[model samples]
Target chain A: MTSARSNNTRLLTVFTILSVLFMIGWWQETDVSIVRADESDIGFRVNPVIPTNQEEKNASWFRLNLKSGDTQPLQMNVTNTLKKDITMKCVPTVAVTNPIGQVLYNQMTPKRDDTLQMDFTKIGPRPFTFKIPAGKTMVVTQVIKVPKTNFNGAVFGGFVFYSNDVNAAHQQSASSSKRGVSMFNQYQIVVATVLNINKAAEVTPDLRIDRVTPMAYRGNPAVTAQFHNTKPAVIEGQQMSFNARVYYRGGKKVLFRNVTNQMNFAPNSTIDYVISWGNTRMQPGNYTLRTKVTTGGAGPSWNLVKNFTITGNQADKLNKGTKRADYSWLIIFLIIAGLMLVAILIAWVYRAGKRSSVKNAGH
Target chain B: MKKSWSTALSVAALALVAAPVFGNVASVQAAGPKSGDAALSGVGYANTNGASGWPAAGVEPQTASGTSVAGIGFVAGDLTLNQVPVFDFGVHNIGSSETFSMQPVDSAFRPQKLSGNPITADTKANAGVRALVVTDSRAQMTQTAGYQVILQFSPLQSAKVNDSGQFLDAKGSATTDPTKFTYNTGTDNKPVTMSGASLQFSSASVNPSTDWNAFIGDSLDFGDKAAIYPAIYTNSGKSGPVPAGSMYTTQTRLAAKDAPAAVGTSIDEGKAQVIYRANMKTGFGTWAYDFTAPSSVTMKIPSANQQTGTWVSQLTWVLVDDPTQDHANPIISQLEQ
Candidate 1:
């Protein structure tokens, strides 16, 4: 009896320890090294053309300083280790700020912006194409002839190289027609070339708040303010501070109060800055969100106010049917506890029967 | 007896509970799909009958017994293209046949040091071999072997000129016409005739110094004197000068036919470059070719065939999978590996 009881206790103890360890494992985050099965074997590299006296080695991009109307000759030393020969088509493209707040230079067909006076297609080299022998290096040249008239600030553009093998690349981009089994991995890389025209120019940078959006960011409710730099000059050393408040229809009761500061902007770029609200339950109601932004110590400032209404149906849609998994540990623990209760009940019944049998033997 | 029964029941219960605590949690979801791939559908059960009664979100006892078949497929790996050289051959004396070297040069056509091209070639004795980089990751999977890479070049074709019927000259000056430039669109039977000036191609020795053996680590075999095969493909028995639109293949030492690459090993067969000399006829028009000519091969051009304005042609390089008979099964056999 004693040995059996001790065995049960030991078994229960080991199981309890195991359950705890399993729970901890489930709770902790795991980092798994996932190797992509669809990654392409084709690769290419763009090496910056550094002049004889320059110090940058194997730099990823190029920065050129030139006077207006000054013609500069630029060359890219390209190497192709691909097994097949490639007809590399080169085009000059302009960089613009995307909605996601990052600078994009690889837009195939970019819309013309009035603020960007210097045209990339005009000053850049004619579209050049050359064959790179497999495992051979070929040099492609582009001569940028700045307009004769003097201009200020910078002209942002990039020389884009593309592999004209659409058929082969397309084959690698899609897998067998099976429904769940699809794989694609052909991507293009762009080298950003920033041409800083002349050394010095005096210009004013314009800042404007483009839009404000309410959405979930990183699993938290937040408001993102999208802003843009309209001028060709880069906005440097500028500081921004804003106060955001939400009030009821008549501006009587305040519901949300947020204050943000020290937001900076890139040159000719747009950024979406998010301010998070921690798990605040929002109800359908009229609200007023007002913000005031100040730039630099004594430079400039802007005020923005917007009145909006949140519909009940929209709030219901945003919060209504979202579902999350229950904690695995909690469910497992409850199941274990219920099993333990049944085991205890069984033991009690067994003990009671044993006592009754012993008493009957005494009679 | 009663105590033993109770203890046995408790132990059985515990055993039953512990079975699924660690069954297959490691394979919960196959992570998210990468960009440009298939989007994620609704949640899938690793071991469940989805067709009969799919498990809803937060549904208990969601698993069912079924054989899951995860399929594996092939995609071309990302290869690196680095250090492409700009071939800017300046003006040529119309009557004289000028030979240009495909070596890295400054704006003045003088040899210069590039990122990948070292300075030892300045003396023209150890001239820097122009090379491109191609990295393959297909062999990364356990079932895959190395791939066979192939390269082909298109003939020099006509490019667009400005509306004024003028194109940029070598110095970016608008002093040329697109109509004046014509390539040697010759066949094996009917090669272009040059009266006085002729275009020529000269083959420079393949650079054997590149560290091709080290890129693939121990994954690939280059032993037994296996060597890269560099040749210009032509219908004329690959003889004389390589006609326009011919293919030039640089020799790459492959895995020895005797041995196969082990499974799950990726190999990079280092750099391979084919260098050639270009001797032109009717000197004004620019022509591009990978023509791996013999040391002193020349094609003559008659002055009557020459036009005054500058004419430019383009060279196109294309890298594709080697479709040769020997490489039909470029991947080493899995069983052999």
Candidate 2:
């Protein structure tokens, strides 16, 4: 009876400890989850401090109509939610279209269209890098002075806010020992500031095919067609289709084709639509590019054809630079191996015949 | 009599210990955010069901085996990015001379129950699945132009630095500089890198059919628009006799007009790939790009450039307003009205 009681006591102790540990671990896990969730929320948010002349009361961005030579202070509330003070960089950039036909405002000092008379970066104050206190909202003010020369369309630009705290997190992650494609995310918030000098109806949309060239796109050989929206009116709210085809100058066969549907273009921005070569080697010859753009409505449409030539040197350089697998050495090795096997077989046959002849002679 | 007493004491002790654990779980469940709680607004919660609307604002939680398995809240947003997956390629042997592929490990931020416990939630659970999610609640009173999420990456760099000012891999192997580590595109300089390394993602599904329906027309069923296979059918030009439960199915084509924006694309390191794009008429509410089974979200590593240490990279997700839309003119017209 004493031994049995001892065993029971031990069992109870062990079970109680395990249960307590399990509960502790569960509680710890919950605490960690809550802490992680809080960490994810430890960033800054931007709200446009709408001016008296702000057009849209509910819009998150700034939309104002200012006359030429009008000066106004554009302000945004940068609220840092973290416990520690954070530094943020404010980049004022002109809106430009990317290769994927989407307009981007985060690009700084992007090449401005030649027809863009009113540049937003020049009109707004220079880029500001300032610090915000913890749990405090800092009013980041930029004095916008419209150009004296009157322009017919709107000037699209934005103030892109990037937190240094996020970059510090990136640096910390980069310095850690974690391996194998570990990712650190950096967040950016763009507050678009649209300045309209004239009415939208007064401006007409014009698109021009600026240039075409053979270039390396995403590490692959591709031909980029630069679509430039010359006029300062946004070409949007309408479905547009772009069909680009490449061929040997007069040949009817299409060598490569890229048809992109439902694309929009920004006002006074250039979009470089890339046509992938699909691993085809660049050849030295005259090539023709035929591009057709159509909007379902009576909007602007174009069918343009351009002729260009690639030199032998250019083709050789491009083909060498492309990331395609080069199996020339493997092919040569396989061919040589086959020839050697044939030679070995012949030598063996010769030796066998000689041995048979010797044996027969002895018999 | 002594043996029976010992046994009873042991049982009592166990029951005493276990009762508290169950009690704690119950307390946590009771303390969870209630449905239609305005305090939980502007925050993102996991949506296990294909149901629409905010999870905290009166949306029903998913019940599994008569137990509530609702998603916990994480991250803040009005036009907010709720979750972005962390792709971890686990440990591997060094000096591999052949190409290999790795799938991302299960996410660290998997959906938790109301008791702050992790359940084996399937792909239906948005937070449990390893995916990317973005929620947009910016539209009010009037329709807003959509947004774009651009993905940009950098080459894999060493995550550690030794005392000698050299970058160290996970295995304590040191390189002179972190820049020496490169994501080899096959024809590059001689360095420690995973040759021809690339990341690809597919299998995209969006929530709140109302957002998609507003753009793709109400005739087609959104659930049937799975990314696995393109389902194309010619319009019969008439509402003929249809099978049961297939009333909403109509002439669905995989063209740009009949579908949402493309989400599946291979991302090259050091280049910006537009992973998700919502044009003028679509991409409202929340959308997730599921990287579950069958949907290939893989990291390809060639054996020739396999280094001994852990490699790290930066994935910067840039969310911006669509530049094509004129933000000023519309508001100006509203003011004129």
Candidate 3:
């Protein structure tokens, strides 16, 4: 009887252990879900630590006036609000203008404009990645060393900061491919930096028409005028207007016209202003492009004119596969009408001749 | 009686000694700041002020409660990007030329007022649509010269693999290069891609505070205090006349400065296209661009290029500073003079 009681006790003990293990596993699973739910709301904030030499006291961006060969340290504070640690990538890039005339600061590697005297990427901060601990703030510093030579105007650039952890997580989740189309979204923050050297230099903004070409824009036939801002100063603020017209060489009739207002230009940048030819087939001819520009309602203005030609081969290639107006039926009807009129005229002459011959025979 | 008197005497002495010690502790606590308390030191206040909240269907700012969608949260900055859309092109048959319309699934979060009161009892009425929302509070500090939002696209890649090994399921495995839209062109299988894969928008609306009605009235019709701005680009025959309270206004229309003829803009892969632009003295508070109609956003796949399996792409919404505003810098003008 004692032996039987011991065996029963052992079995009961094993059952209790198994039940405890199962509860522990279930709790762990629930805990993971809770952590993931909290992670969805995780975010961070970054702020520029302005130094004493900042030119604008109330400016949110970095505006500094420094001499040639001056060295300064630009600092920013990154604060992590979540309990888990996060990694961030910081990229310092030079500013470039987009096609629509907006100054873009987040391009990793942008094509340098032809008239760019000084490259900001060379003197600006070096790109780097750093980590911040959970619920802590970290200071990121980048040293800017100006060249020995003095330069005019301002060197425009910006620092782009984004969380590497969030990107990695999204990439991992997006790896599993599915049918159809899937989309992923990302967010980045940019802080503009303007470094000034020669404050006494003149700020003269000028614009010139580089070239005009006929090409396909967005898969549609169009004429594009390339406008080059050949100066170091930016054309901004004042309401700027652009009026472009295309015409046959030396002809008064205008073939195409594009008018745009309030557009701005970046320093030493080029913009391709497209004039679309909607539903019209490209024709081979000599065309003249005339462009007029006015800024700030009554500010500065320019009238530019250029002559360009389109070849037959170019027109044929551009018009290939494009729907055109069909004229085959009209041509066929004209040919048939001309033949019948000729036949009726011959019949009338023959009758006149026969009548004359019969009169002569009677005489 | 003697024992009770002795106990009272002892209690009185203990209270007298403990009072000064507690007072000293309180004074020390008052002198020192808490561990988490931070002091921001700079010449100007940091623009890192968090966004107020998401906007409701009525276009009023509403705070989110509980769990929210991924990448939907408060970003502490004067210029904040609140939300971007997740476009889903539903499953279709393989190797058949077809034009697919976007089946946009709205990921709406529960909205609550700043006072912690629920905006609507039924959250369904306040469901979000396929739109991009941005908020600019820099105007509060007299910093005008608004911002620009541009869209950049990456080529669609194969995101999933089938058990039959028909689709290559490698992560970020795109069938086309960054510049083109043709998918799986060089692969052993037939390639698939749409001719014109574009994201079209029907309207761009702005919801400003009621306090600025007088200033807004100068440009727009402010018959009712709760009027929204006019659509920047309205699809033909899709939108009606502006309502009684809400009048179409040009107060905040700054996109005209860039593309005077911006309607029906086309997008190319790996190229940045300026979708929305705000110029000087415009684009304040909450703004959204809606693309929720059937034909508003579309992609056409030729029957020959439709290879079976899922295709994927990425659309990056970038908010950038306008260079035109840089010319107005007080210091730069001072130097020019």
- Models sorted by DockQ, best on top: 3, 2, 1
DockQ of 2: 0.09
TM-score of chain A, cand. 2? 0.73
Q: Which ten residues in a row have the lowest lDDT in candidate 3 chain B?
A: B328-337
- Is candidate 2 or 3 superior in TM-score? 3
Q: What CAPRI-style quality would you assign to candidate 2? A: incorrect
Q: Where does the lowest 10-residue lDDT sum fall in candidate 1 chain B?
A: B278-287
Q: Judged by DockQ, which candidate is best?
A: 3
Q: Which residue pairs clash within candidate 2? A: B36-B58, B98-B303, B170-B310
Candidate number that wins on DockQ, 1 or 2: 2
Residue range B1-337, candidate 1, lDDT tens digits: 9999999999999878755532322112211221232322222221111111123443312142222334623232232322222232334456454332222223332111122333221111111112222322222222222222121111123222345544433444553232222333346633233222212223212224432222112212122111121111111111232122121111122212211211111111111111211111110011112111111222222333333333333222322221011222222211000
What is candidate 1's CA lDDT for residue A249? 63
**Is candidate 1 or 3 superior in lDDT?**
3
Q: Tens-digit lDDT track for model 3 on A306-340?
A: 88888988776666523455365788999999999
Query: Which wins on TM-score, candidate 1 or candidate 3?
Result: 3
Candidate 3, which segments miss by more than 4 Å at Cα?
Answer: A1-44, A50-52, A55-58, A80-83, A168-178, A199-201, A325-363, B1-78, B89-101, B104-129, B135-146, B155-197, B206-269, B277-312, B326-337
How well is each residue in A88-185 modelled by candidate 1, as lDDT tens digits? 66667776543222244554555666456776667855566666556444445577788876677667666666665632443333222121111122
- Which run of 10 residues does model 3 chain A get worst, by summed lDDT? A32-41
lDDT of 2 by residue, B1-337 (tens): 9999999999999888666444333222322322223331122111112211222323222211113334643222245555555555555676442323434334354332122133111101123334455545444212535666677766665445456534554456775333333332334543343334556665354433322223223312223222311111213122333222112122221223212355555655555546665554444444444343322455555444456655667677676665454332211000000
Clashes of each: 78, 3, 13
